[model samples]
Target: MVENAASATGPSIATRIGKLDLPAPTLMGSGCYGSGEEYAPFVDLAGIGGIVLKSVTRFPRLGNAPPRLVATPSGLLNAIGLQNPGIDAYLENDVAKFAERPCAVIGSVAGFSVDDYAYVTERLAARDEIDAIELNISCPNVGSEGETFACDPGLAEQATRAARRVTAKTLIVKLSPNVTDIAAIARVVEAAGADALAVVNTVRGMAIDVETAKPRLGNTTGGLSGAAIRPIAVLAVWEVARAVKIPIVGQGGIENARDALEFILAGASAVSIGTGNFTDPRAPQTVADGLRSYLAERRIASLRDVVGKANPGFAGVR
Candidate 1:
């Protein structure tokens, strides 16, 4: 085990979330890690828990337009859409890279309808390189007057059920933080057969240019991520944890181990490093290592023991 100031032999930080077994409780968030290729040269991939790629759809998307990114006081605004080579091309090109990675690789699937989600997930489910599938239902549903699937419990359950019917692979539903009742959505997805839940995706946000009297993002709207939304993400995780029995992958504004630890204490069994990777190429490794040091300092046996430590009747910490 990685030691702190006082040396003490203890259990490994290894933990299990749903059907996925992670060596560390830290993961490379989708979009930031970019299929685990961008940061491979800067960090050791063998140490972290897993790597989730950006959202992939059934067909190629141009992904919003230019000027789709801007730095905020404490976060990043992005409207990248779901730019990818589509599912067929991705299965041929990107996923092939993980064949010999020797680490967990998760695929994030997004779609416009229930069938779209199922088709993409079905393709991903057939792949051996992918250890799990995260459903990005935050995209607008054309069948529902542009309302996001994550924003409606009924739509969320339908999307999840459609995907579940096709793949026995670990299904992780990424919930939206913009909902009025996140716990209600969490329960519906769990009942629909989600093995685990990604507590929250980017919070809904937007920025405007005062000079031009126009929206800053090309899409006119974007998702807000980074340090600005950590508190919201934690609260969402806490609510979902109390409402369901499945594991939770907490994300949002996790930059370092402290932020990641905060999520774990709140109820996240695993923490994802999102916008942090942009400023620090080694964010994933740094956070994972820091977690080891934290376990040693607190004398916690493993990350599983620290998960949801702050929740009532928490079993991880004694």
Candidate 2:
């Protein structure tokens, strides 16, 4: 019966990440779904395979002060600082609201210390609604711990391994782009028992105010997302896909179906929509539709045909 349901859903976009099997290639990025309620007005949540909830922390975060968002040429800069209602509030209120949706609900988690990651994961493990947890060790808006965890492979490994111990749910470590070598970090996390890797979180960046001669964002620096970072995201996904055996969930500046296709070709088993959601509330559905049309037009039968197709030159291949 389970196999029939998966097959009836049509040519499968579903793929396995660690022990979990995602139902489709399209996943609503963290923050893009915004607690799942925001998407109800814009889309039929059941159509998408999964929805990754916004980043949640141990305690409530008010986030950075005003000017939290800025529009870039093709992307958006945000310094929201992980402002969440905290884990307890989320599991009590938010998770239940979307519990009935057909899609999987994956939580995006952040923390100041290893204990925090374990604490939150343990709490989430008790919930039957969540399908996986994407650890946000790459948040650039934080002052100290967040940035350090991502920049150092050892720290990334420690945080991921700690979270892994507390939960049986699939664990995905979202990586940062502000690193010297992303492949090095990917290797370390995979070794630490990460179920999968979400490559290329927002690249660290800043915008200056001409008149005041000061930084625009209150945090002084923000992570860059959207079209401007697409190429970089693809490159990072390609490199990491080669570096590790685990599946990769790719995101950066994915705005349309074509962009999503690029990531799949680059080796992402799944792709997430970030800044594009702010521009078009239906961006996830649109991208999903686009992927379907692209596949049909090309006479391709399954998404597996495209995953890692671009990395033809990968070592050991003739």
Candidate 3:
């Protein structure tokens, strides 16, 4: 049944991740989108579904040294080291500002241990302005320990369970692509109580300077994002979608609607835009507009109709 009688108005782009509902399916990826305010001047925040604020840890971090970003042929490598003002300062100074955002405000929590996730999530999700929480267990740029939770199934389950115990708000667990069996990890996370999963964070990669025979980034290794990781992310979403019942926020190298559609077809309920913002801050609008156009052209009743349409093994909830 067409929920909206106006079929000509185009298919509904609205989507749900756990208890949270979004008018648009396009979300600005965490870390890439800075608090939804910085890009407000260049793009309409209302045009997108939500903004995943940069990850905040229990303590302040100075971030990595200079040369944090390196543009490759099809992608960019970055090692920013999760710089933030710590939970105390963020709650006191920054959480209040999110109240003005036109779209859903999703807070991101990064930590060194399970306790850190619980502490930050309890405080951040307690804020009325925050619509949801994203547990960033797959930050590859913060050194070896940074991605430990995401790569290790036990730690991933423990961290996710810890955060789940603190809040009833939607929790999206970010998984690492560097792992050997991502779907297995996804299953464990889902069982541990993640409402939704951010399928496949940046692929681990590094670039070196030939002349100096040294690593280009100060951290030596960085997470790669952009067109380079789309296939990896898509496959991860496909496999994880088949292995779990929770919604999947497909991301990686999504730059346009077609790129996002690939994930939706592979069983992702929604898509996230990160490096694409760097290519063009208006990328979110372009994707949102393009998705509506695609639906209108196909006469699809809603974007949900196409979720997992291409993947036979998809197991996500409608």
Candidate 4:
């Protein structure tokens, strides 16, 4: 999405991706701040483009057992299992709060089947405050030999098309880095009607307890997210960005503005703050402000001017 050189009097940080527009590229990653209610007291939510709520399943999930999270050298290893209140409870209890949000609200939905995904999107689309739908298709599909939908192109397309048919709101399909070829999955989802692609979800990894030689995580395996996965995430974003025309929200281990900028350079139109939130609740604001400073120091007025300019051999990605 790179374009002509920036002018000092160009547009502000306000930007657009597909059907949604935002104040800036900064966004809260899913399951981090939980609808921005917790971070609202700390950071100015109005400055961020949107907040991706916790992943919601059709039914309530108890999530993984205790010891579900562990700290690694770079980030956290978590097997939270998409724990959350059932969709019905969320609509009755939390959906209304989105109306009070100062920025766009992106609802994150996780499902085991195409129907399950569609049903959640169907209900969430009814809410006027939900500006977009981010399908967390990283969960295992019951009908697909327990393989995660994000890891399979066919499953990913099915999941995307189901939700796309149910909602006209901006549809973002979150891809998993666990795949052998991320661009393949990204392309198929775009063909299935995804408005944007949240390139690169968490990478799979595990840690073991030294004392007992047992796995640290209760599930024995968990997704690794943080500075460690940032490189991989950037690579995934770059590959998918080059392969697809749809906008991409680059994420994974973005601890600061520098990290987010790396994603932008890799062709991400927007960036999401995840594990960084746990360390600093105001990470989103810090990133947003820092990004502006970066733009100002370079005399670039529009955020789009710098997008994808870092991809080697690609003079520009207009």
Candidate 5:
């Protein structure tokens, strides 16, 4: 097995996400492990570098109807419409438990309006438990203006700036892949004071039940995630990373350490495992282990050495 060169005797995996220096290059993305309740049994939460909680809305959400998830070729599709127990409940019940973990706790906040965003961000900011906040403005299946806000650069900037006003904690704006130009949107968010960018949320897609001649998911359209979207996610990360100087958290179909390394080579400062987690509960650990092996094999000293290495070749394309 390839070992991480850095693992033997190199710089620490702990790197800066905006001003906050994290413990490792691996961080759990929003909506991956649900609350700490489910993940604690499978792995030591303290051993991981960080955990981004499930998306919390200003009010409680019912999510979508049944048949919400269906497995595709190398991924899955889901239209889980921001289902959560609301911010107040989350803070009172879930946040405290995760805060006690060894790694940093990043809260993922979502809202339909600027006020909602501000309110949720303000609540999370007041807490010492939350290490950062990831603003979810790109959910395509939501009824509100989330999709619009993410698509329009001006709206994306306005929303991000509004959230930045309330929170002193690190703020990361998750971008949508449906936009015409992702780099343009990235620039807007960066200028609006976003600390980091999570490139390319799941691409919008739909599957049909051929026999019944009906949509497979109750919600007509769902977000696509898994190994299938890895190349697209990699391209998106490369573009956004080059457009903005801030840190990029690249995710999409990362099934193994090599896949994670591909994102690093494509310009991600760190990687998040989404659908892969469902297939292998220990997916993140495997990816982390694989990354270490890859680094050792390549004689690379640090994750920093590989980040944005793919940018130079893509300069002409952009």
Candidate 6:
């Protein structure tokens, strides 16, 4: 167990992802925290860094069928299929509500084509409520078309560049962990003008039902998250950090401050909590507290001082 520090005035966890300045380094992962409203009753919205709203597409999606979620031995598998109201409806009903959120509100845009990315990003970022735009180019549950932009370097560049052309607001391209060379993709996306990179979306996996002799998820295959992919996520952040100078929002199986610290040591500027929220609604605040305690114990003045401390190959700003 980590010992609590008497005072949290020692190190600063504030971080900047692109142009968005976060008071804390913890961001709530998209699809996990719904616009920062669902968790407000249980957790303090202003205590965390920011919230990446669920991915919104150009068209409304029905999402996947039932059995969209399954608990694995060490993680959780999900195939939500980017289910959300279309951008039109989102702008009308959702965007207005974000004005009241205490923390940063990052809009997530997921699409099937480069044009779709540009269109969605332009509209979403134009709103005053959105602090930044996260291009979810690597959604694993929507079948082959979903992850195509992230797998193909050319498509990744095209999508990133298209979105870049539309919005000067921070453009964070979410990379897929299913790729063969994530570092290469990171370089491509960076060259195309991405302000930051979301190290990994989720790892692909599936479960079989013994009695039914069929897949458990409605989509057959789902993206695996939680501790199961922590190593993979850390390695991805490490490699991408060395390959690009942009900031990285590290995620994947991060459950506590210790888990979040691993990504920071591996070169991530910030950490995102997704599945961790399910374990505890107050996980975000706990992580923030734990990070402060860890830094205070070591007499560290700021969290940035320890970024990439463990990775000798880290190329991001120190």
Badly placed stretches (over 4 Å) of model 4 are 1-11, 140-147, 312-318
Question: Which residue pairs show backbone clashes in model 6?
Answer: 226-253
- Candidate 5: regions farther than 4 A off: 1-11, 313-318
lDDT of 5 by residue, 1-318 (tens): 112344446445555787666657777878877865577788766546677788898899998997888889988898889999998898898777665677767888888887888899999878888889889889877754667778888889988999999988899899998877999999999999999888878898999999999999988898899888888999998888778888888899888888887888888888887778788778877877777677778877777777777678433211
Model 3, backbone clash pairs (residues 3+ apart or across chains), number: 0
| Candidate 6 Cα outliers beyond 4 Å, as residue runs | 1-8
**Residue-wise C-alpha lDDT for candidate 3, range 1-318, written one tens digit per residue:** 112223236678888899877888888999998998899999978768899999999999999997899999899999999999999999999999999988889999999999999999999999999999999999998878879999999999999999999999999999999988999999999999999999878998999999999999998999999999999999999999899999999998998999999999999999999999999998998888888899989988899999999999888584
lDDT tens digits by residue: candidate 2, 17-66: 66666556677788767867777888877667678888989999899897
Q: After superposition, how far is residue 4 of candidate 4 from its true place, in Å?
A: 24
| Top candidate (lDDT) | 6
lDDT of 6 by residue, 218-314 (tens): 9999999999999999999999989999999999998899999999999999999999999999899899999999998998988898999999999
Q: CA lDDT, every prediction?
A: 0.81, 0.82, 0.91, 0.83, 0.81, 0.92
lDDT of 4 at 306: 81
RMSD of 1: 3.4
Ten-residue stretch with the least lDDT total in model 6: 1-10
Candidate 4 positional error at 90, Å: 1.2
Q: Residue 62 lDDT in model 6?
A: 98
Question: What is residue 140's positional error in candidate 3, in angstroms?
Answer: 0.5
User: Candidate 2 regions off by >4 Å?
Assistant: 1-10, 313-318
Q: What does candidate 4's lDDT look like per residue over 66-174, in tens digits?
A: 7878999988888877888989999999898789988888999998888999999999878987889999997432223324788888889999999999999899888
Model 3, position 288, has a per-residue lDDT of 83
